[model samples]
Target chain A: MSLPAEERVVVTGWSCLTALGANTETSWSRLLNQEYARGPISCFPTDGCRVTEGAEVVLPELPWLPKKAESRLSRASRLALPAAREALQHAGLLDPAGRSKLGHLEMSLSTTATSMERIEAFVRQVWEGKSPIQQAGRVASYQAQQQVNDLQTFLGFSGPAAVVSNACAGGANSIGHAFDLIRAGLVDIVLTGGYDILCELVFCGFDSLQAMSPDRCRPFDVNRNGLMLGEGAAFLVLESESHARRRGVPILGVLAGYGHTTDTFHLTQPAPDGTPLEKAIRKALEQSATSPSELGYINAHGTGTPFNDRAEAQAFTRCLGANASGVRLSSTKAAIGHTLGAAGSIEAVLCLKTLQTGQIPPQLHTTDPEPLVANMLARPGALLEKNAALSVNLGFGGSNAALLFKTP
Target chain B: MNTPLSILSWGAVSPGGLGVEALENFQNWPTTVASEVADPARQHLVATIDASILPEKWRMRPRFRRASPISHYMIEAAAQALAPHPQIERNRLGLIYVSFIGCSVYSIRFYRQFQKDGRRFASPMLFPETVANSPLSHLAAELEIGGPVYSQIGDKSCWSSALRTAACWLHNGDAEQVLVIGAEEFEPHQLEAFRSMRWLAKPYTRPFAEGAGAVLLGKGPHSGRPSIVSLKDGFCFRSRNESRTAAERCLAEFAPNLPVLDSAVGWIRPVAIAALKGRTVHDGIPALAHEAFGASCAWDTIRAAQRLSIHPEERVLIPYWGLSQQIGAAALEGTP
Candidate 1:
């Protein structure tokens, strides 16, 4: 069945921070030139976290500091808050120097040891017989809403807020779900992105899954290892086109449409043949009302695992057929480690930047590509003289999602 | 664009309990214990599925299988819900699944294994299912459904909000049938963690009286019989107990003499209120709730399903609240 002919969803703003650089332009610029962002993960000592190496985003030393905030924010949130702040600025949803009406959404996996410390303290409190204070500490930390409560109390956002935690698809899923809130008029402006701090819980989880690459993730490459876990956040400001037009907001790209599905075949293994994934692409295409031929670029969910790249490749081949080669595709993970939940949004911002700049980012270390996607990867982030791009993401539990973006 | 929505057929395996029994046994459900998905392993099963039963797929190299029998409970619940619902074009139906705590047993297992000997016991296959949203995502894939599939993990209040989101999608012509599921499986340890954190009450039980419900929401009607009452409207409130007050607050303002089905929705929430409310209503079409089977996640949907045979004049208050302190209070109007 074809997509229902209806209102076109458009991208309004985008932002990202990755190993390629601290901003979308810088990241995509180097990405298009086939530069690799692989480096030793030094932000935290990766001593006991299993395998090493990742596309770790190098935080640029900010010369200026805002003197107002007094609370300690996790690194992932620090990355996300700024990117979201900037995205809203670009969309004119947030005044450059002031606050604005906005709904906030986030998709995250594990955060660092912040909660661990709190829980430990709570344990200590109970041991010391400070039961009431201990109870209070446990209540706040174990509560999922604490994150948003913290965000609201810190950023002063009075609008609607929701946190989505769907593993790898978290970021894109957040953006996709957030778009609905906007289209449905729940909110005029929204900030959708993802965050995950480098944490041992996550480290152990991935290690147990054997999904982590000992070396750099070589997505679509025959010699691929697994995935290099990365830490960072990405955000996008999505506004209704009518609102953007009236306010004359600077549109970065269109949020377009997204497709989400679960394979259900096995919770972890992708539908080895890619049936659900193929269906996901079709659904996304149908939702966006964009055609396979119109998609000029793709940010692949190339986690560099044996299963993911292969599954994604087969899914792409099924979705695009010969048109698959016509679209330039690359895995930003080659530059930045897979940000788990943040990968989708960060890559989305990069894809938007690619559309805005007309350059498809290049894939580095793509030797001996998977046969199915070999031809597709060879074109690695070629310029899209015409501007429509799609980002593909899949996560554990057989989730497969796709998003289409268009330049304004 | 409000695309026309066809109420595709629906199938469900919930604790008001199986097939037409769920609809037929709508009166004071005899027991508070929830009906669980029949365990396939323990039963002498005639394998009708021609497809090679890859049951072992759960233990794959990259294994991340949903633990706690509830994941599978939700799957069969969904399979049942879809089986009876209008078979919408597979291409257009979408799945929306929600839960409060995602798959915790795997995390529990992972932690125990690591604590035992980090490398010696790590099962790759058991790892991925440890994350939230895995079951919803997995169920869609397993169904081979080619529709827009999504999931949300919210506290009690978002239970109705999740439905509202599905309705909004339908209103926007996004899909035909939106599969809404709430499933949860508890690891004794996870509950232990909750207890340590004071999130739980005591030596906990599955609270089978609380969980297990799935619903297919679209524009159409059930095949054999007309609905007892079509769900009219629902709003979210703050807490389970607070939800009752929110419903009471709404119920107070409306015509007191009007026919209303007062049911307490939510898993393990405002527990004995149902019995108390049932006693208050006396013999009239008292109420329906998921208090029998431990709550698998859904709050109001489970309660709403119980009133399928109620009259059109009956107004159903489905107050589904969440752990996040958000409350949704909505009313379902029975129609001619």
Candidate 2:
């Protein structure tokens, strides 16, 4: 699956902000220890809500961000700015020496809602007879690209930007699109990933669907009820291999292949047959020229919902055959609750970290695993040599995507 | 340089009316403007699409029964672009939905119910459409297109990004053809926001409008078709003062010598006009509807393609000055 040196895309740097911690290293360390981030929802009222537990991030202060425009920035942008800044800094793009390439850096980020929380507040104010004119900034930030705008303006990146809003699979879609851009030689560098913030509207919507777990997020567990919502942002600096080599920066991993497909079956529910998901997985493997046995780890979309986990497990079995049980599998959602739009990118960062550390993140808070996934689920914390890893995500509206990352 | 893409076909649902012919015959259509009191102190001028203009076949489809108006406009446009080419493999067709303000009508309605009925009684039906991708998924399902599908959100200039993405898809062999859609639904809150920001044009001067536009793109030089010659986007600006410079720079990087299809209106129109000074610029605002957000660019692109079709030896350039942050330009030429 390796492309020519000029076309090969590599991950140069990555950073994430999750409930487990404010940065990638902290989240990864806590994840290995099986430290779960679920707790009582504190960002907003959950008095009458069925599921009260969710993960919320406490962001660190970013002094470089202009203070005058702070109020106009959405919580999603606040979370994304620090992650992208760290990513750029890690990739050395923040240095004056590397600043010349900023204009060529295309941005592909994803989110379900940019500032839905602010939009809710704006609507309520309008209902209370408040002037819509006064709260107009909130409406401006409602578009998901507002976050991308914030990142680009703050970081001084003047690249063509795309904001994916494919619900849960958005993050992976953004990254996948970035890979496509690089492989097509449209841009040599890209700032990509996804971010979402927990809002009452989204939380209530899931609760109304009875898709929120009443107890805890237990992915692939026989007793699994549903998912717990969470908020965070993750970003990666992607560059063509030739660009990375010219810059002499460490190539974290090779983004070998990307496969995305749509399941036209339903808007909210994935097809139980998992045929579309299987197609997505097969496409990724075929594109990468990697066998199922070569995949060392799988970061499942396991939302702890019965429908999602079952379908995903079926897809793995259908696509991997006997190799399904051989590849170590886990859902980081067990540590940081289902981040919705941010899930795929967060897990992509986790997959790269997993390959780097050779540490498999365990499926936490589960007693009895579902029969379909029992054989492949990771047991506790285990270190093993890794070659390539897969991160798969299924979104609302039947958007299914799988990303394969290989060691460079 | 990116691979030049050929436009196989195009479609639109603009303030003028449904289908690209309406845009071609724009002078005959009356401007339907509504005065709205989005702010008690100020009256806003808005141009909304007539729902009755949607074809009965598209309007009555079971898949679109509960869908938002934006979805209806987008699907209708997509149908116009794809229906004629039934021979194209569905599995080899990709879709990209681009928008600035997504599904605001549904999102506002969903939140209103959530507020009035409390969180426990929130309606799940309206919540799904609140996400920008809802309509895109519907488009894929109704069209039975199983290829790669995505929803991209940005300003008017994002059209350039979507075009580039579609070109990449076509070039990668992921899909033989890619459908790019730019759509926006009329919503009161959106109007209120524009009015509050003083971005709305004077009534009848260049009012903000809503609608959808779509184009089917493929690789190679198809004779008699309009092909994208070059694209230069990502001219980021931090302020109004910087926008003119960005537009000029983007134009220079694109094809500065070609006749321009301008996608700028409202306060940013001057920036676009200044950048292409002395050039033969076709102001599409009069024909395609002014200040249509994402659709503004789409209409301009579709019009440029039409122009190229009629004038086979000519090349057209488009300069897009978005409401905020960025500028972009695209060049198109009719194939020999």
Candidate 3:
């Protein structure tokens, strides 16, 4: 399954703004310390909901945005643009004009909620009769494309862009699409990532589903409850190995393979048997041509919900077989909360860091590991024999995505 | 260059009626329906589907009944496309669901309930459907498609992107067959927005109607199907000059010498016309302005398939300019 050198996609630059920190370095340090960033929700009122805590990103200001653009863009877009800008700068694509000149650059963004805060504001105005029906048109324009348009305007980019809205799997799906595009020689450079913001709409919705934990999320634990919501954004600069070599840029890690599958068994729940998740993991391993024994770490999609943790544990056992005992498994969601759409990308960046730094972050707050995952990380950090790792994300709509990465 | 893919089957649910036949019939004799918007002072003409026309099985399914109307439209359209090949392996099929705004009505309902009645009153049933991927998941569950399912959120130009993605999936062996669907359901907020934007014509114009369009794409030179000669997308044209440049570059690759059939809608028509200046291009094709918001691209592709089916020796270039800055163009060659 080895790909041609020209077709192999690698991550050259990456940036993440998670609840744990504003940048990758800070977040990595916090994770290393087993810090939990969950606190009482301040972004919106949670008077009637059982869930009161969340992992929120507190930024001083989006200095890169123009004053005029700030008023027009949504809060989610504000969070996303800075991360994208950082990624481009890290990749050396940013120029003196505050724009990237790389020809044929493409962008694919993923999100579960695109500017829901703006939509809620507009709707509130409409409900209060403060705004006319014509003014509500602004709400109509609050789709995922608005984020792309904002990024394009801010970066002065003129290329193809797409929005992948696959719930929590969006981040991984965006990166997967970028990999396929570059691997197929469709484009040389792609800026792909995911972002979401805390909003009343999603909060109340999750509350209704009873899918939120009252306390800090504890993944892979026997006493695990539901998930805690979080807000953040992450972006990666993915390019073909040949393209990276031509520009003499540093490669952070190789995006060896990706696999996407749907349960089709339920709309909001994973298949109890975990067959769908196992298939996705197997497909990713097969595509990357890496044996399960070679994988050093497994960033499980441990949402902390009882069903999700149990199902994912079953999947690990079924897919890894005997190698399950050797893999160091952990879930960053315990530290950062569930970023939903941005979870996969943020975790992927963490995987790249783990590969580069050889430090496996601990699975915070898990007192007792699920029996199925024989090698769940209970300590602070561990060294890896092989730098290859896997990050998995399962989202609403039974969407599952797995990404495989190795040290460059 | 890669080998072309075939359009094995297609289904559409348009304003005129249901199924691909309805789309074809409406193309010959167009009709319009009266629709009301949030601005109660006036009534805007729209092409809306009659839900009663959908098959009983779809309407009666428990999941379908609980799903949103937009989900129903996509499922019905996909059902039509899949009806032709019942023997195809469900696991080998992939689905790419494309839409501009997904289930706005449900989103509004969920949010409105939460705002009015507080968090405890929020509806769990509606929350899942509010996400853009809900419809794709429902369609997959109904069809039992376990392969890779993706939901692409964009305007008209998404059609080209969807097609390109479907082709990529085929080339990458992700799925043996892929169903590319573009769908939009009429909601009061969307109608209000379109009216406010002045995109809707007065008196419920022809060709512009609410509908869903679907096509089954597979690696080709298959029997009795037109081959997609070349598909290209990801052209961002914010201005006329940029549109012209992107169009010129795209045409140079897909159809430098062949006669083109332009299918751009709304503000993008001029850009497409400018790009095809001084070239052998056809422009009299009826616009699907009455179809649902995103249906124009799918309708145009269907029209391209129809034209190629008649003129097997010709290659037609279809250029798409979305309301957003996204631009896409495709070349389709007929086969006999």
Candidate 4:
């Protein structure tokens, strides 16, 4: 059943932090200019990692937060607070001082490895038979919910919160659940997004899996090797149409549809045929009552791995059918690397930008496009006016989620 | 938001035993055992589950062959919940796994190996399970479920939050039945952290426990079945006074006159005291079930459903006082 006019969800604000830039506008501009953010690891020594280059964020100074209070936050929360503040400020829901203007607002955030760096340090201390009292706060901040808690405590929103940790698709899943909450008339507004930071254990794990690109991330390219790890955060403000109108805020776009499905085929590997992802795409389109032909732009998951890119390309071809050749598609991972859990939401912010300003971000470093998506890749500075844009993510555990955004 | 959900079936793999019956009479099942602590003078009270409690058939399943204990508990509890309803379509069932500290055992194992060796020595197989959603993903893969599934991280009161999300899914016709599970596994680091925080109980103050609890919810009409009538949650608190105030406000808005299914473990918490003031409270489950962390509220919910099954005329209110952050309440009524 479709929601009533008053309960329909709309996006009022969005922000992202990526290696390319610190905010959505800068990231989008740098992305259009084809500036690659991949470089050698500097924050921590990449001693034995098979892959050394990564996309790490250079955080801006947050003088608003006390120095002592900020010290307690993990890197994930450190990246999230600024992005969340920018989103709220963009939506006119908060003042410049990082305080909430609304009475009650909920939150739905996602993360795969929440505060792993802190947990690693804590584990080392404990394993060494040393006193872990100093690291107790770090251990307590290890769960994925800790970031949400930090956001609530920082933003001063006293609404319900949920943290979705469905691997890479977590970002879209969090946004999707937020949309569902508003559409179901459970809550009027929600601040939804996802964040993840680079940690030694996770980076080494991907290297152990041989999923990292030794060279550069070349998604949808015929000679693509694997993905490059990145760290960042992205947030969006979604509210019911009635609530937006009541607050007198300008609507950026409409959160048209959300499709969440599982690919029980394999834990790490998606089904080679890409049927499950196709089903997710179809489900999203069905919810919005928008045909495949209506979709103007698509932000493909395109992790630059063999199985993921091939399966995602196949899913797009099958779902879009004839429209596949005409629809503009690109993978921003080629520029900023794959931000893991933040990929879906960061790409979502890009999709909304494309929906609003017809300037589709180009796929970087793809010398020879794969046969499947060769005709669909966008050119640099390509301007294609599209009313609707689709963003999809295929996570590590065969979770596929799609979010469709339409111009209001 | 106030959608009535029929409790199709329930399951548990608590310190008591394997099913809801084990929880219904958990007080007589076994007593809490003492586990060794870092201090030589005293020990910590623990209620851990044995691996043998799981069905032998699960061992042969390739999907669960290398799964962690938390995954096993989650799958076993969900299997039990779906056991009686053989005709329920797997593709139409949604799964939501809620946990506070999730899969810490596997995380510790993976990190330990990585620290011992080098970055290249990090086990790929173990790394994927380090994420909070790993157990739920394993359960979904094992059961071959193709519906919407999510892994929500929160304190004990998140069980009520999951119920609210499940209710939304049911209201939107996303699934015929939504299986909500709260699962946690034992890890020494967690115990040590608890000890350091002084939240750990010495003898019998408030024993710490780990296990899984699940309930299958649907919007279908089933006479005499226990159904959730109201859920008043999203009461975020910062301190004890705030928690008590939140609990009082939640109870007032949810079901002020219903018999309360209290979530107090053993101590007289400020939130519990506020909820227990002039109310018909059922504190037996928390007294016997111990504190399963994230699974605590699920246990309380399952016990409320069981109470409704026997006394169809009673309406039960469950007020949840989380370890931190939020407070909530769920109201359940049995149909005539």
Per-prediction TM-score to the true structure, in the order listed: 0.77, 0.95, 0.94, 0.96
Off by over 4 Å in 3: A1-7, A130-137, B27-38, B196-198, B201-208, B239-262, B279-285, B289-291
Question: lDDT scores for all predictions?
Answer: 0.58, 0.83, 0.80, 0.83
Interface RMSD of each: 7.4, 2.7, 3.1, 2.3
Residues B1-336 of candidate 4 have per-residue lDDT tens digits of: 556899988999987789888776765655455542343234565677877878888877887888888998898889988998999999999999999888888888887897788877889889888767778888898887878999888777788888988998988878889999998888767766665545664442466677898899998447878998888677877655677677767777854567777567533265577567888775433445477777777788888888788788888887766766777778888887
* All candidates: DockQ: 0.21, 0.60, 0.54, 0.59
Candidate 4: Cα lDDT at A117: 85
Candidate 4 residue lDDT tens string, A1-408: 336854568999999999999889999899999998989877666788789889988876778899998987889899999999889999998966678887678988888888888877776776676665666677668766577678878887778888888899999999999999888877888999999999887888788899999998999998999998999999999998988999999999999889989998778889898999999889999988889888889999999999998999999999999988678999999898888888889999999999888899998889888898899999887776658899999997788999999999
Model 1 lDDT per residue over A120-202, tens place: 34433433444332355454454444554444444445333455666677778878877776666645556677755555556
lDDT of 1 by residue, B68-160 (tens): 445565666676677754445766777776666556556556655754565534666565566666666556656656565665655654455
Query: Using alpha carbons, what is the TM-score of model 3?
Result: 0.94
lDDT of 2 by residue, A179-236 (tens): 9888877777889989999998898889888999898889999899999899999999
Ranking by TM-score: 4, 2, 3, 1
RMSD of 2: 2.4
- The count of backbone overlaps in candidate 4 is 0
Q: How far is A132's C-alpha from truth in model 4 (Å)?
A: 3.0
DockQ of 3: 0.54
Worst 10 residues of 3 chain A by lDDT: A128-137
Best candidate (score: DockQ): 2
The docking category that best describes candidate 1 is incorrect
